[model samples]
Target chain A: MAEEVILLDFWPSPFGMRARIALREKGVDFDLREEDLLGNKSPLLLETNPVHEKIPVLIHKGKAVCESLVIVQYIDETWGHECPLLPSDPYERSRARFWADYVDKIFPVGRAAWLSTGETQEAAKEEYIQGFKTLEGELGDKAYFGGERFGYVDVSLIPLYNSFYALEKLANCSVAEECPKLVQWAERCMQRESVAKSLPDPHKVYDFLLVLKKKLQPQ
Target chain B: MAEEVILLDFWPSPFGMRARIALREKGVDFDLREEDLLGNKSPLLLETNPVHEKIPVLIHKGKAVCESLVIVQYIDETWGHECPLLPSDPYERSRARFWADYVDKIFPVGRAAWLSTGETQEAAKEEYIQGFKTLEGELGDKAYFGGERFGYVDVSLIPLYNSFYALEKLANCSVAEECPKLVQWAERCMQRESVAKSLPDPHKVYDFLLVLKKKLQPQ
Candidate 1:
């Protein structure tokens, strides 16, 4: 039986990018249904993800998988014959899940650095930098967060690096300066066809954020 | 070599109870080191989980696993010879992860209902009930959130039910009244020795909440 996979997603969403990168890496042929998140979400998106009404919702053979990392794991497990995203060992898999979970935990702090204003923005930026340094410590001299290959934690995080330029512009911070090793890692991830093709241009993301910031902060 | 397992936890914590329940369900021998969250956290806890500095850390053979749900999954995988917490099927595992993630997402909303006051409390209570109803809809007559046997989602949520009595007192609501089916499911979970023995007394939890509420509200 043939498998049918569809992703309901918004472009420029790091969460959505994780699923895209995972699918691309697995060499899976899937349809992309771009969503209008700022406007009315598609009925398909709403019906598929009634609980959160959020993307990227991965519909596989009519079953909806919500949450980006969960969808990535689903894709990896389902198409595991081609490429394995997570480590096979239980301990290593747990470590992969741990780092991915850490990325989830710190996302709001990173986003707040760009989205917020004044003292809140200042505090968020400091915390975000600290978070990056912590991740740097984890990365160390390793080529990838997954160690040898571009795997789960890499897929989980590399997507966010797409918006780093935008985030830096808004927050007046330098991720490259704060965590040079992580910046090098991001550059390495960009060399991958899966990650490069999945991510939007950094300058375009920065331009989008300029408009978004006006809407978010107001004059 | 025998597995050296230790759980660093605080009583009355639903998150901590999850690890206890999972460990018990797996029939794994372990030590419990209670933390004084109100006072000083143990140096061991500090060194082990420096990132979050939170409890319910499962130290297996000297390696620490933080985050309650992640620890539960680790226990299930490490001791997978019996009592599999997560489903083996990729699709079902994805669904379990989705629901468990949903529970994690709504926890702050549920916690805030009890922690806040006046209009904020009212709003949080309303949101919390809505979230519970959403979960109830998902349960839909299943014996556990995992459908047949008590499994991942069940392990994820049953711990929270331990404080239902306390939450009810603080927010002036009844899970039995609002979510009758889910309340029944909670009762079924309580019959399990794993869940039954791990949870603290309901009245004791409520009394603890009274003290906590005074500290939180500070009239």
Candidate 2:
């Protein structure tokens, strides 16, 4: 019997989407449990991730893995021979990990800026633009962050690109126009069956953000 | 002949210390090249880590690995069988990675609070206390973050403990008194030869911070 794998996630969470894309790409059989971020969380989610209380927990054979990148790496390590997210060479793997860590560090800051309101929002926007531009400079001419391959770094970053449309609408600035190569890379990723199936429409994500903003506002 | 591993680093940087500690623990013979944070950095440092010209950069066999955690992982992957920073099991590795990622996320917020000077500093201190309390709660009775063995998570977090004394002094509160388990764990980590040799003295770290504060202050 195939070992049971369960993912606790929200459909719109990029972190959750990372695991879904990896599973889909690898053709792994798993069960998905949708989580409502606003409502009372399931005991499983709370018990599995006592520290963070966030979604996107991957349970494989009863062991839980939290953090999207960590879970993705776990998937790669366990099923590395099937569909390799990382490279065979240790050095290449290190570089892939480096870029993935960079994405992890900056993504939150950018997301905060993209989703923020008022002065704090404006400050976050500035930080986001700076981070995006820096990333663009680093990317320069590569087909993917890993260069010519949609490897671990690409897997870590591509899902977040789905939010660019929402950020563009909210921040009133087009990331595509500013960083053409990133947009091109994102477009390429969107064409993949895994990405296409795993992510919701950009407009839907934007609408979700709007609901979030309204709910967060002081009454 | 072993390939020359050149480390681009700044003293008193916990991130840089992560790499240093890993290298020392692995007993990997490497050349250390210090980078001036306030002055001009070497062309090698900038060229090696073009995206974020921040230290520390580990140049092994002419390939550069930036980001402290990534470099530490690389060191472990390359040489850990000799002194195993990460566990052999895939599940355990994933758990270690998750805690390391959690530390990465929360460390900055804690540091920000620890370094603040006035009324703003109070809020940052509260944030740090809250973060530490949560960590203590999660840690429970574990000897190390990676369970009984002192592995990758310990290496990743131990150096950051150097900042605690300065933080306590700055915040006018004792994290050691508040979170006794965490403090004891950190103290136990200091007993390791590699950790003790590599870590800077707490008083010296505070002195360095004082110098940094003066340099950063408005004239």
Candidate 3:
């Protein structure tokens, strides 16, 4: 039986981008049905991810897999083995999972940096810099997070590159200056066709975020 | 060499209970170093999990595994596959992961129900009921979340059995009434030695939560 693989995706979500990159890296032929996230979410998305009712859901073989990292793991597990996203060793796989989780959990820092003002924004940028520096320490002369391979952590963190632009413009900070190796790593990741194609343009994302900020604040 | 397995655990944490349960389920003899999480976290816990500075950290043969579900997966993978926590099939494994993710992500709903008061608490309790009813729907008539197997989702959620008492007391509600099957599932899970021995007393947890609430609110 032919596999029916579909992704209920949204273009600007960094979480959504991870799924896109992972699927592309595995060379999976998938239909990306872009979601109308702001105004109206599709019924299929609501049905597939009834728990979260969020995007980047992987519907494969009539089963819905929600959560971007979970979707990435699902894609990695169910699809092409030639390019494995996660490590085969148990400990190494755990490490990959940890770093991906770190990326998932660290979003509020980045959001505060991009969306807030004055003292709160300043503190968040400092924390964001520290967060990236920690990632830099983890990267630490390795070609990628799992050492030389483009694996799970790379797929997880690379999607944040577009967000870096927003932080740079809005927060008036440079991740390049703050965490040199992480920026270098992002550059390396961007060279990959999968990452390059999956991520949205930074300017567009920034504009949308500005509009979102106004909507959120309602001033 | 004998496996040097040590858990950096805290008594009040459902997250910590997950690692404890998973390790016991694998029958891996190990040390449980209870952390003074509210006061001074051990330097080893600090060193092992520098980013989160949290428990439970499952240090297996010098490698530190943070995050509860990830630690559970590590234990399931590294030790005995005799009673596999996750399913063998990638699709089923994804489903297991999805439901486990569901449990991990639903902590805030449960927290709000326990911690807040009046309208906010009432709303959170409603949300909590809806969330568990969703779980009950997914659980169906299955002996566990993954059919008859006491698997990943079961392990992920069963630790929360202790928290049920806190909600019942503080929130003035009953999950046993709203989510009867889920409560029954919790009872079923408690029958296992892994779950029974690992989970703390519900009353103790409730007391700690009350103390925590006072500390948090400064009232």
Q: Which candidate has the top score in TM-score?
A: 1
Query: Can you rank all candidates by lDDT, best first?
Result: 1, 3, 2
- lDDT of each residue in A1-219, candidate 2, tens digit only: 238999999998989999998887787878999998888899999999988899899999887999898888888888746568898777888878877877777787766766676888788777777777777776789887777867787788887788888888877656677778788888888888888999989999999977876787646
Go through the candidates in order and give each one's DockQ.
0.82, 0.75, 0.79
The best candidate in terms of DockQ: 1
Candidate 2 RMSD to the correct structure:
2.5
Per-candidate TM-score against the hidden true structure:
0.97, 0.91, 0.96
Positional deviation of residue B41's Cα in model 3 after best superposition, in angstroms: 1.6
Clashing pairs in 2: B113-B124
Cα misplacement distance, residue A34 of candidate 1 (Å): 0.8
Error of 2 at A109 (Å): 3.9
Candidate 3 lDDT over residue span B103-179, tens digit each: 87678988988778889989988988887888899999999988989999999988876788888987886887888
Regions of candidate 3 where Cα sits further than 4 Å from its true position:
none
lDDT of 1 by residue, B1-219 (tens): 247899999989999999999999988888999999978999999999998999989999888898988898888888955569898898899999999998898889878888988899889888878888999999997888877889999989987788788888878856667889988999999999999989999999999888988987788
Output the lDDT of residue B24, model 1.
Answer: 92
